[model samples]
Target: MKVVAIGGGTGLSNLLRGLKKEVGNRIEDLSAIVTVADSGGSTGRLRKAYHIPAPGDIRNCLVALSESEEIIQRLFQYRFKGGELDGHSFGNLFLVSLMDITGSFISAINVASQILRTKGEIIPATTEDIHLWAEFSNGEVVEGEENITEYGKTSKAKIVRVWIEPPDAKPPIDAIAKVQSADLIIFGPGSLYTSIVPNMLIEDIKEAVEFSNAVKVFVVNAMTQPGETDSYTAYDHIEAFLRTTNLSKIDITILNTKMPSDVVLRRYIEQGQEPVIPDVAKIARKGITVYAEDLIGESQDFIRHDPDRLTEVILRAVSHALS
Candidate 1:
C-alpha cells in the first residue's frame, strides 16, 4: 500500500515510527505530509530568524522514521543546555544549517533524509512561508499557533475556526500527488487544531483528499488537549476535523477505549485535560466505521498510543479490505 499520513506534532511522528516497520510488508511506500505552520518555541524562533517553514515537527518525523544508528538519532535529537542555543533541538539546527548550505528548505529536508536514512519521505505540507491564525468563538482572532493555543487555554475561549496567513499556500507537488494516489490516509492522534487541522487549511491538499480513493481514517487522540478540544468526545473530534477541512466524511475513525491509572489521569485532569470519552456510537451512527481498542500505552507517566498495537490494527484493517 502507498500510505500517506497527514498532520504534524508528536502524534504524526509517533505514528510514522510505527508504520516504518511495515515497509515492504504491508506498506510499499509511506509518506508524511507535515504541518509547517508552527510559530512557537525553537521552530518559531528559527522561522523569524531564517524565514523558513517550521522544522520542529519535520525533525521529529524524520527522526522517528530514521533508520540510522541509535547514536546518530540521539545526536540529532540532542538539545544544548544553558547556552545561547538553549532549548533548540539539534535536529532543528541541523535542518536550518542545511537550508543555508543548500539555499532551499526542501533541499535541506532531502539532504537530511539521506543522512538520517529515514524509512519514509517526510514532506512539508507547503514550502511557502506560512503562519496559522485561529479565530475564537468570542470574536477574538489569534495569530501564531503557540499564541492561539495559549489564548484559547488562558482565556477559556473556544476556537471557532482556523486558517493559514496566505490562505492559499501551495503544497509541494508530491504532497498533492501522494494524497491523490494513497491507498490509506490517516489524520491525527494529535492536537486537533494546531497539529492535524492546520494541514487541512491548505486548499490544494484538502481538495486532493476530497478526490482521492484512500480509506481516510482519523485516529482520535487518547486525551483531550486543554487548549484545543478541551472536553471533546470522540464524535466531537470527528465533527471538528471534518468541519475544518470541509471533507464530507471519514471512512473510519479509531478510538482508544482504555484509560490510564487514576494517578496519571489526575495529573492530566489537574492540568485541565481528560480522557477523551469514547462516544463511539455517535460516530458510528454517521455511517462511518468506528474501530475501538485498547490503544493507550503509558510510559514514564505519559499516555500515548502503543505504536506496535496501533500499527497492527491499522495494517489489519487495510489487509482485510484488500483481501
Candidate 2:
C-alpha cells in the first residue's frame, strides 16, 4: 500500500513511530507531508537566521521514522540547556547546517533521513520560508503559527480562517506524486489550524487531495486543544478543517471512545481542555463512516492517541481503501 500522512510534529511523529514498523510488510510506500510554517522557539529563530523553511517538524518526523541506534536518536532530539544554543534541538541544527551545505532544504532533509536510516519518506509541504496567518472571529489578523493559537486564547476569539503567505509556495516534487498515487491519505491527529490545515493551504497539495481516489481519513483528536479547539466537538473538528481549507471530503473518521480517568479529566478541564465528544451518529450522517474506538493512552499525564492502537486503526483504514 502507498500511504501518506499529513500534519505537524508530536501527533504526526507519534503515528509515524508505529507506521514505520509496518513498512516493507503491510505497506509498500509511506510518505509524510509535514507543515513547515512553524514560527516559534528554536525553529522560528533558525528560520529567520537561515532563510529556510522551518526544520523542526521535519526533524521530529525523521527521528520518528528513524531506524538508527538509540544513541543516535537521542542525539538528534537533544536540546542544549543554559547556553547560546540553549533552546535549539540537535536535529534542527543539523538539518540547517546541511541546508547550507546541500544548497536546498529538501536535499538537507534527504541527507538527514539517510543518517537516521528512516523507514519511510518525510517531505515538507513547501520549501519556501513561509509564515502562517489567521484571521480571528474578532476581525484581527495574526501571523505566525504559535501566535494564532495564543491570540485566540488570550482574546477569547475563535479562528476565523487561516492561510499561508506567498500563497503560491510549492510542494516538493514527490509530495504531490505520493498523494496522487496514495491508496490512503490521512490528515490530522494534530493541531487543526496550525499543523494540518497549513498543508492544505498549498495549492497543488490541496488539489492533489481533492483529485485523488485514495480513501481520505481524518484521525480526530481525543481532546480539545486549549487555545485552538477549545470547545470543538468531533463534528466541529471536521467542519473546521473542511471549512478552513476547502477540502472536498473525508471518507472516514476515527474518533476515540475512551476518556482519561476523572483525576486526569479534572486536571485537563482546569486548564481549559476537555475530551472531544465523539458525535458518532452525527458524523456518520454526513455519508462519512465513523470508527469509534478505545484509542486512549496517557503520556506524562497528557492525553494522546496510543500509537499501537492508532497503527492498528490505520491498517484497518488501509483495507477499506483497498476494498
In terms of lDDT, the best-performing candidate is: 2
Q: Runs in model 2 with CA error above 4 Å?
A: 298-300
- lDDT, candidate 1, equals 0.91
- Could you tell me every candidate's TM-score relative to the true structure? 0.98, 0.98
Q: Can you list the residue pairs that collide in candidate 1?
A: none
What would the per-residue lDDT of candidate 1 be over residues 153-205, giving only the tens digit for each residue? 99899988888989979999999988998999999888899999999899999
lDDT of 2 at 25: 89
Residue-wise C-alpha lDDT for candidate 2, range 1-323, written one tens digit per residue: 88899999698998998888889988899999999999888999898888789999999999999999999999999998897999999999999999989998888999999999999999999999889999888899999988888998899899888998899999988999999999889997999999999999999999999999998999999889967898899999999999998988999999999979888889888988989999998999999888899997866587889988898997896697567
TM value for model 2: 0.98
Give the count of colliding residue pairs in each prediction.
Answer: 0, 0
